[model samples]
Target chain A: MFLTVLSILGACLLIAQTTVLARMPPWLGNPDLLFLLVLFVAVKVDTFRGIILVMIYGLMMDIFSGFVPGLYPAVYLGLFLTIRYASRHVIVDEPVHLPPLAAASYLFCSGAIFLYMTIFNPGTDILWSWRDLLLQMFILAILALPSFHVLGRIAARIASNRRRIFSTAKGGNRFIS
Target chain B: MRKRSKRTRPIRQFLVISTCIVLFGVLALSFMGRKELTLPHRLIFDILGTAQSGVTGIINYVLDIRNDYIDLIGVKKENARLREEIKRHQALTVDYREALATNVRLRKLLDFKEQIPQPTITARIIGRDPSEWFKTFSIDRSSSDGVGKGMPVVTVEGVVGQILDGGNHRAKVLQAIDPNSAIEVLIQDTRTQGIIKGTGDSYRLHYVLRNNEINPGDLLITSGLGGVFPKGLPVGRVSSVVSKRRGMFLDIEVEPMVDFSKLENVIVIMKSNQLTE
Candidate 1:
């Protein structure tokens, strides 16, 4: 119960991050927190549960943010599944890897929409200037680093505290083994 | 009786499960498939409209209450704004009436089409495109309201521009100042034709031959050579005439009678004057 609560708390914090980023001045750029949340979940939870949580959060983000809907959901699911596979085969517990993963996921989400537009809505005038893309990348890099670091630390602390409390309260017999 | 109850258990469960399944199916299908495809989607639309109206009403009520409080506190800024808006609207109504009266008078005065035969649609300018070079503006009317790409838009006084791009209930009009804008204009008095081309900030009557004998104050209306704009609709007045002694063509600057900077309302010209009842 505590772990579930903590996971939800993490999700809410992610939402708050998105809201703050959105409210910031336009020069700051729109940094997506949905990726950070998915990455955190992938590291903290197992594959199946991670995917489910990320899917729900992705759907919520898609509904909240203004754009073609489902664009976030499909991209987030893919990100989660990849992270899960990486966690299974690799050491994702390290702190340094999370930021890069978050940044890459953010880029994927941003690029996916443009890719979809280019293919489906052909001949419709769309501008792809280099200056805009660079600005977006810089903003995403700045946002993803701090978010991943803080959220990763918070998730780790909560996980440890839950383990300690559960061990003490249940005499070490209540953990699902 | 015991055997009958045992047999009924699975059937009852099946009935309940089937009902739940159908409900979920309806909801999921409506949520996903119905939005982009066959379903009328009127429920979503109605809900949205109701929400918008609700918001507008709340805003109006709150603003009214706030203004009352502000008046009590000796801040009468809103009153000044209201008075300003009132004056502006008064000017607009007067101009509208005057233009309509002129159209009536002109139709009678001239032996041309006695009736204003073409149908018209009045749409509000809802948004401005961010691209400066495109010089595009969007209006509320769309294909559903008999509006299409290439339809000409104008104020009662003169031409505004042509609808360059369009969607279901939204469209972008390429303003007269756009580099790509072109129209066939005729001198209303002599009926001398010239190609009206945009010169960045305003349009100029181009390709007017040296011998056309054009002068300032010539009313250049749409020539109706292209089916897009109806002929005889006032475009602009010839502001300047450059008489080149040896040049092949003359440069005539037209002052667009419709002030694009202060465009408040516009009417879409639907078809030729002869076609409508």
Candidate 2:
């Protein structure tokens, strides 16, 4: 059930990213809503399910984006696993951690993309602009707290519903085993 | 407990090994270009493209209505301005009549029409590239509309880009201002040759010798050397030229004639036998 909701959210964000956000003014920058969602899942959801959904998000990114078919999935899975592991030990779940985490993830993802293209598709003259990357990071940082807040609410609701179902099945009011 | 740990160890090892193998396989497959889309990808593209078209159409309609309202606010002033402009153009039409006659005679003498009646299909832009690195966009026309990859796209102002790929109902265009794009061009006044390459928002002309005299306002038109575009199509004007003391070539910048930021419509050349190599 949680996977279904995340999948639907991913699909909606993909559609809007391709259709609406793509049309926004070039200078304002396009925030990676899908990337934020993946981070949200990694921090709030179980690792196994979060990784699976992040992989799906990557596949959708590959489709909507003009990149190679499997490019995004590989990059996204790596990022997802990294974030999943880091959140276990670090205090990365709070809203205040959103800016730095978002910036780091954005740089990692963008750098990985450039590296992959450079290694695989040699002689492809890619214009690497740090200005554009910085602009995107700034926008993502601004959006991170609000975006995570909404995703956290959804994750909490899903978790509570699962707890309720489990308790009802065991014929007990308290969920503690 | 020791015996159970022993049993789970092999399963864990197998899962780890299998996961690594799968990821490497996916990466390898992606590393090699997959030109053909899987059936599922095609189906998804079809559905999403249709939805995008519908949503874009409605959005454009609302925007047009709002623009109309804005235009109404200045309609009277614009009407007066246009009336004066028409009078000025009417006076200029007499000179234009003579020039048109001269142009017809010159064209006939040069057999211009014999090799230049190219057919073009108009297309509307539906979406733009989601990423900033690759300057590309999707247009409403596709293979079903007689559009195909490698077709040159242009607008009334000048060259736009080339068709990169096509689904049944839509096609993706790689814009002229992308890093991957390159076009052979000639300076209109001096006939100097150089390659115009995309540098994100603008174009940069390359390969001209450092000693070459190129003014900032000189026009750059397609040389048609590679047969992708026809001869004499406007590409851009040289916006700036810098002669570096260390390099053998000049660092020249071109301001594209067509404003990509404002592009909403384009024309795709269907066929021109004279231009096709």
Candidate 3:
């Protein structure tokens, strides 16, 4: 389990490096590996580890990015907690429509970004246009989906195989012991 | 215990979705009107910011070369064309000299207030911040050039933003187009007094009296009310006027004279003879 989480963190660091270095050469769009990790934990991980990972991820982000000290970590971790709590009690249908889920995720991300900026910059006069944010969110999600699909498949394979390994252990208790 | 079947999950699903949606909205709203972004948040923003500036530099470089740079075969032709244009402009300057001299003398006779004497340094705007929300920028000049905080910066066109911070050889300017920037302005014709501000898109004339005799197309100039700015510098032109009988204050929109976003080169005005401390 520790190795798995470490691997995920390693991948995220790689993504962050790419974001800073090769990133959309002249394009301002930097991919959010943080968001990807949050979504992965919220959906794939269960139990206390999921919640712990949220805080861990948020802290890592705070340490790495130049956002306000506590804002993003608190907000993102809060999002993770909300997602985790919901997943505990609710059943997400498999073969679910990806768009709605993507939209929901996009909304969550926007809210987090907005909250962080608004809270930290009180006196700064900024026109918070919901229309602009919504438009940008949808567009970003659409772009993210192509990449998300490939990652999602890899993720699902890993998760399913992990489940298989655990269940086999359950059936062969005497032999294993 | 056997796990609960999926059949009973949707009711629970509705409740969860509704709760999550509500929680997100509330969290988002909680962030509104926050006073200061914590240091960590600012750091993340800066990293992203640096990356953004890097991108802007690349884009501007490419755009500049595309617009002006040409293949070897075409370079000479372009250069010659620019030289001829410059020569024509020089000839026109000679023709305008007499009238220009007259305008200057008349302005002196009218007793245009003397520009306060202070030491000054000039710099060029090198990079603009990625997020318009911050309304900040990085310039090429810095401490090595004697730039420092609280120094009022201006362009050949008009007052830009002040120097907020600086590095060894580079400085950051808070552009006048930034929503956070506020300047005192006077209308050219009416001499109407009001504060000029930016709304991230354009400059606005705010705090005008409801009954002020203002109209569209009025030229707004710096009143020098703030000790930071020199008098009579062009600020912007009044773009719109809002009048409602019961309205507590007049809503006036002014378009800034300078295109802050497209700012490439700028002049730094120093109070005459003042040196960087």
Query: For this target, which candidate reaches the highest lDDT against the unseen true structure?
Result: 2
TM-score, chain A, per candidate? 0.67, 0.87, 0.61
User: For residues B211-270, what per-residue lDDT tens digits would candidate 1 score against the true structure?
Assistant: 887878888999989677877888889999998788888878988877665554567766
User: For candidate 2, what's the TM-score of chain A, rounded to 2 decimals?
Assistant: 0.87
- lDDT (C-alpha) at residue A72 in model 1: 55
**Higher-scoring candidate on lDDT, 1 or 2:** 2
lDDT of 3 by residue, B88-110 (tens): 99999987996797566445423
Best by the TM-score measure: 2
**Each prediction's Cα lDDT score?**
0.67, 0.83, 0.66
lDDT-sorted candidate list, best first: 2, 1, 3
DockQ of each: 0.01, 0.30, 0.09
Please identify model 1 stretches exceeding 4 Å from their true place.
A1-177, B1-115, B244-246, B272-277
Q: Candidate 3: misplaced stretches above 4 Å?
A: A1-106, A109-122, A147-177, B1-127, B167-170, B268-277
Write down the DockQ of candidate 3. 0.09
Preferred candidate (DockQ higher): 1 or 2: 2
Lowest summed lDDT across 10 adjacent residues in model 2 chain A is found at: A62-71
Clashing residue pairs for model 2: none
Question: TM-scores across all candidates?
Answer: 0.39, 0.68, 0.51
User: Taking the tens digit of each residue's C-alpha lDDT, what string does model 1 give over A96-150?
Assistant: 6655665565566556655765576454323344554566556555666576677
